[model samples]
Target: YAGPLLEEEALNKAAEKGLSSPEFLELCVWLGSQIKSLCNMEESITSTDGGKDVESFQLEVSSFLREMACPYSSLISGDIKDRLREKEDCLKLLLFLSTELQALKILNSKKMKGSHLEKHNEVYQEVQTICDALGLSNSSASDILPLLTNVEQKIKDILSKVQNNHVGKSLLTKPLNSEQVERLGKINDALRSEYECRRRMLVKRLDVTVQSFGWSDRAKVKTDDIARIYQPKRYALSPKSTVTLAHLLAAREDLSKIIRTSSGSTRENTACAINKV
Candidate 1:
């Protein structure tokens, strides 16, 4: 019976012993799902010669879950308590993944020139919103903000898959357990710290590069300014979402080419900005 084909005799024997054992209730819930797979769902409840008693078994398991939810009546509504009976731990994890995927979509929409900082802000807000609403520990906004992604298409794919799994309206997503929440928090923290360290080094490199291109004090762009100008958007926003700078840059209009002819100083500043990256 454990394999694909269930022998009539073996199934009958299992039904007899299983119904009388301490694990009878658990067996009933499993049997319902198994019956759903089998061709004879109706016959399962009707006593068959092999020894399966389907009707009483289904009733007993349904009552067991209902009784387990009884003590919390004062706090939880009847509808919610019933749903808790069927919900599994994995369902909550899927729900969290769905939320983050949505956040990624929001970040992807913000990809553009000079919008990296703003994108970081929004992604951070989304992450914090989930954490707060779900009673997850509040993480550092600045540190988490940089984790956002701008990859729209990839996240769209993932979100689509997750949504497909969220079929029913009934399976309640329990608040992420403490361990799961903390693990995600630590991941965000570690990633943000790593990104911050990388940005610092890049800024230093940018400073050196800018100084070498000096025309005048105003002509030399700061590394931080360069990052604002050319550092990849995904790298810029962290702990919030992921998006690459190149992808957004390609989609942006080439406005620099349209700027009118200017005086020497103006030309130099504009040239520096355009050529640094």
Candidate 2:
């Protein structure tokens, strides 16, 4: 389907909505797993384009990347451009592990084997039924896991460069088609509605990345320190139970003055008060 060229306006307007969307966070967690899956593999494999589900999963991620990419702006440097392209390619490798692939993973699991659009077709049911009836005899096309590992770092780096960029048109670019913009726009809008849920999901998924990228060992994200990002800002004691050190010191000084002013009999009482403190 034709979409208007992704204009900067849409991305500038990119909503942080749905960060907690199960599907979106699930995808993010899936992405971290993809990185590790690629890293552990012996080689990279590719999937042949297949069912509608594959198309849907691919579109969800591709739309996100295209929205994040900046093909029209002069702002991104050559190294960054190449990195973005590599990131896009890495995401495609992740698709090889898609749920559609998992369903076809077993020989007995039905997958649509033939097109209903063909001449003299026997499976005359709707495409959905057609999809439901076919089964895999043995395999998925190829595993691209190893190839994905090679570019994971590159993609992460590109994200670092672009994550904070959402200010002016000249500084960013989308230049995407109508369908992509529209679909992603809705996602951004949905985010504003259920942000708490999304944030929780986002954190859970991002936490997985720490293990995948070995961030746990160093308390960092690539070159950047992430100890601050993952940590919640909380005091060990309650505000009502605590006083500033300065205030405590000043109060102690006043107590000392009271002890100095006390007569011999009252001095004993003041000493007890100081001892209690």
Task: Estimate candidate 1's alpha-carbon lDDT, on a 0 to 1 scale.
Answer: 0.46
Every model: Cα RMSD to truth: 22.8, 31.3
- lDDT digits (tens) for residues 87-163 of candidate 2: 33333333433433353344222223333234213222222232333321222323334323434544456567774
**Model 1 residue 135 lDDT score:** 49
Give the residue spans of candidate 2 off by over 4 A: 1-52, 70-277
lDDT by residue for model 1 over 89-156, one digit each (tens)? 21222233234345544555556533988886777786666555544555554777333332343345
- How high is each candidate's TM-score? 0.20, 0.15
lDDT of each: 0.46, 0.38
**Sliding window of 10 residues with minimal summed lDDT for model 1:** 86-95
**Model 1 clashes, total count:** 15
